[model samples]
Target: MHRRQNVRRALLLVSFLLFPVTFYYLSPYLIIMGAGERTASGSMVVFGVMTLTALVLGRLFCGWVCPAGGLTEALFAVQNRKANNRRNWTRWLVWVPWIAVIILVTLRAGGIQRVDILYQTDHGISLTTASGMGPYIIFYAVLALIFVLSLTAGRRGFCHHTCWMAPFMMIGRGVRNTFRLPAVQLSADTPSCVGCYACTSACPMSLEVQAMVLSQRMENSECILCGTCVDVCPHNVIRYEFGRPRSTNPVRPEKP
Candidate 1:
């Protein structure tokens, strides 16, 4: 489990280091700007791919590959407090309006007229080949915001409350759940659980895994399938199960 986390952290760090080349591909604003010009930007393509990926893998991108996620989690040492997951819905406020504007502008521009995977990028690089301090300023401003949110709000605070990209993948996860599609998900062997809250404590998303396991429902929209709960359980009570969700009788815990 530790090795797995190390590998995940390494991948996240690499992704962050490469953000200079990949930023435009994940830029929410770039997508909107592209729509206004009737161009299907790289961000549009990347977001579409993220949504499709979530249909099968959940938010593995956020857990394993997002540069911003990497940057935020790297600061866990400075502030390891768990975020208020109840505020996860707050991101929709940002995503919905941004999506609406993109659609509105796209329609106003007669829809996407062309595909520009390199939209606004100089030879496919975001920072190194930039013309002036504008890109650097925006990049650092974004980093500063992520830094503040992580330090003040808690671990993965940006992910929980402000990520515009998360909603796209979340919607895809919702579709997969609504259709009962076979996909990567956590399964709990409720009877095997020993009531230890290690899984809950280890969860980066701050989900109540112990409670969810006791309830016999491991499916959570916010679950990134990061496998922290699966890895941390001493009794192996939680495990990754990739298949259609099986109906289970709710397991109500006995009173202490």
Candidate 2:
């Protein structure tokens, strides 16, 4: 388990280091900007892929590949507190308007007239081929925001409250759940749980994973399927299960 976590951290760090080259493909603004120009940008393709991936893997990208997530996780050295999960709803505020604008602009442009995967990028690179310091400034500005949010709001705070990209995967996860499609999810053997609560403490998303186990319900939209809970449980009471969920009920922890 420890080794797996080390690998996860290493992947995150690599993703973060590659942010200079990949940032534009993950930029939410670029999608809308592309729509206005009737071009299907790389961001559009990337987001679509995220949504599709979520249908089978459930936000695995956020857990394993997101540059912002990588940055936030690195900031854990400075501030490792769990983010206030109650504020998770705030991300929709950013996503809804942005999605609406994308639809509006795309329609206004009579749909995408071209597929320019390199929209706004210089020959597939984000920062290196830029004309001036504008790309560099934007890149650092984004990193600065993630740095502040992670340190101040807590671990992965940007993911919990401000990520425009999360909603796409979340919506895909939602659809999969609504139809009971087979996918990766956590399964808890309630009888084996010893109530140690280590899983809850170890969860980067701050989910009440211990409580979810006790209640025998593990479905959570915020669950990035990062497997931290699975890896941390001393008794192996939790694990990854790939299949249609046994229960569609929302996780409701029993009253102590």
Instruction: Indicate the worst ten consecutive residues by lDDT in candidate 2.
Output: 247-256
True-structure RMSD, every candidate: 1.6, 2.5
- In candidate 2, the residue pairs with backbone N, CA or C atoms under 3 Å apart (3 or more residues apart, or in different chains) clash, namely none
Q: List TM-score per model, in order.
A: 0.95, 0.94
lDDT tens readout by residue for model 1, 90-142? 88898889889999999999999899999999888877844588878888888
**Alpha-carbon runs more than 4 Å astray in model 1:** 252-256
Residue 151 in model 1: shift from native, Å?
A: 1.2
Off by over 4 Å in 2: 248-256
Across residues 111-134, which tens digit of lDDT does each residue of candidate 2 receive?
998988899888888778535887
